[model samples]
Target: MTEVLQDLAEYIEQKRSDCVISWGFTNGELNISVAPSNITSFVEFLRSDSRCKFSTLVDITGVDYPDRTKRFDVVYHLLSMYQNHRIRLKVSIRESEAIHSIVSVHPSANWFEREVFDMFGILFRDHPDLRRILTDYGFQGFPLRKDFPTTGYNEVRYDEVQKKVVYEPVSLTQEYRQFDFMSPWEGAEYIISDDEAEGSKLMDGSKGFKDTLTSEQKIRNFNINFGPQHPAAHGVLRLVLELDGEIVERCDPHIGLLHRGTEKLMESRTYLQNLPYFDRLDYVAPMNQEHAWCLAIEKLTKVNVPRRASLIRVLYSEIGRILNHLLNVTTQAMDVGALTPPLWGFEEREKLMVFYERACGARLHAAYFRPGGVHQDLPDDLLKDIANWAEEFPAVLQDIDELLTENRIFKQRNVDIGIVSEDDIQKFGFSGVMVRGSGLAWDLRRAQPYECYDEFDFKVPIGKNGDCYDRYLVRMEEMRQSLSIIKQAIQKLLDEPGDILARGKITPPKRAEMKGSMEALIHHFKLYTEGFHVPEGEIYACVEAPKGEFGVYLVSDGSNKPYRAKLRAPGYLHLQAMDHMASGHQLADVAAIIGTMDIVFGEIDR
Candidate 1:
């Protein structure tokens, strides 16, 4: 691993010596530090270079160091699908300095750069349309900064007089009280009710009611708020749609309503404590997200996961894929007025959630997948049940297919509503069904080959037309492929029976052993209390989550808590292209587009 990185490092330095200043490998992942001024040229070189084709700009983030001369470290993570390598590029700049934007190199970096600007207050020069991407419009301080207060700058409230939401300084010390020194309607030009008139002759021409009417109202195309509350929104996803009668002209997506500051929050929490947060991101298909973070930490520490544990991870990840797809497929059916699919799909979904409960005790936010392995191994009985469930699952899928695949209404609604071409897919950083629906035979499970996925035989489902229907078909087929992987994983789990965790200080000692031995007790004490310290380095690990590619970029700084943690949510990127997808389509198609995008707020709000 070191030797290959050395060759690549040598190649990059030799080829672009003016840009490359220094480079190193941390746990086999290459990290290159370059001059901020040459970022555009350097990134373009990476995308175009034969030996160093880091085509996919996976994520862009900034790490804040309060005391340093260069207070911000703008980091870029890239992946080479063709070369099969990942690299991190770092550029340090002062708080006031703006770095050159790489949007010209990778258009995927648009939202990511805006997010960086929003979170860290880091500026990007020449970004096409840079603004606050995640935070509210009038958001105060950069929430992710080290110095920003947890309580936040202002208390938000609706000002009735102004007829708008306003931000005011929070009075934390005072007990919550409203001091109404003046009447709410003191200055308003409205006639008080007869009860408040305080006069007997109130009806006798005492200026009872003032009529304020105007005929100057002009009509035009309207800007509509689709949802911060509507059902088809999936969760608090609000789109400000500019409409020309029934057709959509522009869609401005306003996110961060549900933002808990996952990245900023992770910086203060321990590795173990932070694992549950990933589950919270993609709530439906949680384990797949946990799998990504687990792989990241494991890669940073260079820990080996046990074969049995790897199989269990694979099995559940496939389950998550089905779980997410079922909800999306059914709800997408519901979006088009067909209510039967969700009812039919969720019946199969409940059984899968039962499997989750059996494995981790929590059905939804199952923080089961740890760094070295899963929290515990699945029992033989559960495995048998899964094997049995796998056989029955196909009938449910086929029944759903009969309902929607050929149904005229469903077909008409989704057939060409949200057509995404291959160019748009690559340009917008689409993944999962978004990528596959565009006819790209690219699945991270196949291209990246994480865990034991390569050993399993499964087909990658690709779509031809790149429309909503094609995306649906890809997901339906992917669910079947997931079942195949799950079945194969069950067999592998039976064959490779061994320790469910890595054998080292990383994995906690068994409870039984802790009671018997002093060394075991010490191991348990340190692990539970302090948590293990990861090696001081940075790694961006991703899993082909059901939605798309959900990634975690971790900067350890050799601490119990991460120095910086940035989540690359595929939904965040996919949703950014909502305007691209919805323009020229009707208002009704908005629901279909959002549904087929398979958006869940858990990740986007982060």
Candidate 2:
């Protein structure tokens, strides 16, 4: 991988001019500094150059350095599916400076640039619609900035006399409290360290609807909001649809209703304290999020996880993947009027949640993943439960397939409904099912092979067409593969058992060791207080999450807490492709498209 990246870097240097300011490797990944002036050309070069076809725009975010003259570092993460490599480009800019938007190069950049603008107040030039994408409609100040207050400036409450909710200046009954570094939840346990609208052209160069319509016959489309409420909208997602009667002329996804400032909170918390927060991102697949974060921290601190811990992490990650896909498929069915799948599917989900409870205390927010490994070892019976479920899940999948995959009703609603092409997949930075459903064999677990995924023998399932039905099929097949991986890992764990947590500065001292040894006690106390210091640097680590490639970008200032934390939530990126897929389709197909993507609003809004 490093060799491929190095070759690509050399090629980029030869082809491009002053666009690349500097290039280096950190945490086994490539990092390049590009000039803000030439970012558009540089990005285009990366996407078009054969030697460096970094066609996918993975993420666009900014990190704040209030003291620096250039207060913000606008970062773009790119991936080359052709070369199978990833790169990070950094361009320093002041808060007042506006950088060129890569939306024309990669249409997925629309919302991402909007998110950066919303969070850091960084401006983007030529971005079609650059408004606050994640914050409240009229919210003031950038919450992600270091100087922003955690409590914020205002609060909303229902006004009894006015009969509506109203925003008012924040009034506190209790003042903001100072930390004494005593709370266990807030402390760092000594872990080892660790768009749119091609309206009339059909976007495929097909005949335009307007070309056929006469002057009086031309339909005028009106915009109507779909959600920000319950029902079919999925979460707080509001789709402002420009409709030509029932058919959707355009669809614009309005997210951020559930934004919780997750990245900002991560910066303020200790490394150990931040693990639980990752769980909240993709609440459905919490373990994978925590796993990615742990990988980044472990890379930063240079900690090697034990084989046993790796196997356990792999097992739980697969389980989380299965759990996530099950809910996705079932709810997808439910969204399209098939109700029985979720009833049967969630039964299996509940059983898996029991396994989660047995492994860690919490079922949903299982912050089980730690810097070096997981919080604790799995119970002896947990593998048995997994094995039993592995045997049982095939029948469950078959039942679901019988009910939805082949049923004429399911096929009618899903088949050829929301078709996405290979070019669109790469342009939108899709991963997991989105690419797989489009018949691309691009599973990060196989391509990048983090944790013990390389050791497991499982296949990456793919679909022939990028339609709604194909996406559903890919997810169903992926769950079976996940089960296969889980069984293999379980067998390996049974054959060779070892310490789950790696022995390092990050892992806390054993209770018995602490009671007997003064050094052990001191290590525990110090780890719980000041925590472990990480070498000053940056790393972007990702895992093949259920929805897509969930990544964590961490910058350490040689402190216990991360200096900057940016999460690349795949759901957020997938949502950007909504308008692309939904145009010219019926408005009712919007729910099917969203459900097929299996987006968790927690991650999207974050």
On the 0 to 100 scale, the lDDT of residue 301 in model 2 is: 91
Q: Write the per-residue lDDT of candidate 2 for residues 206-310, one digit (tens) a residue.
A: 533453555343445567889879577778888889888789988888888898888878777889888889888899979988999999999999999999999
Cα lDDT of model 1 by residue, 384-499, tens digit: 99999999989999899988899998899998888998678756778788989988888899988889889999999999999999999999999999999999999888776888
Lowest summed lDDT over 10 consecutive residues: which window, candidate 1?
173-182
**What TM-score fits each model?**
0.87, 0.89
Query: For candidate 2, what is the TM-score?
Result: 0.89
Q: Candidate 2, overall lDDT?
A: 0.85
C-alpha RMSD of each candidate structure in angstroms: 9.7, 10.2
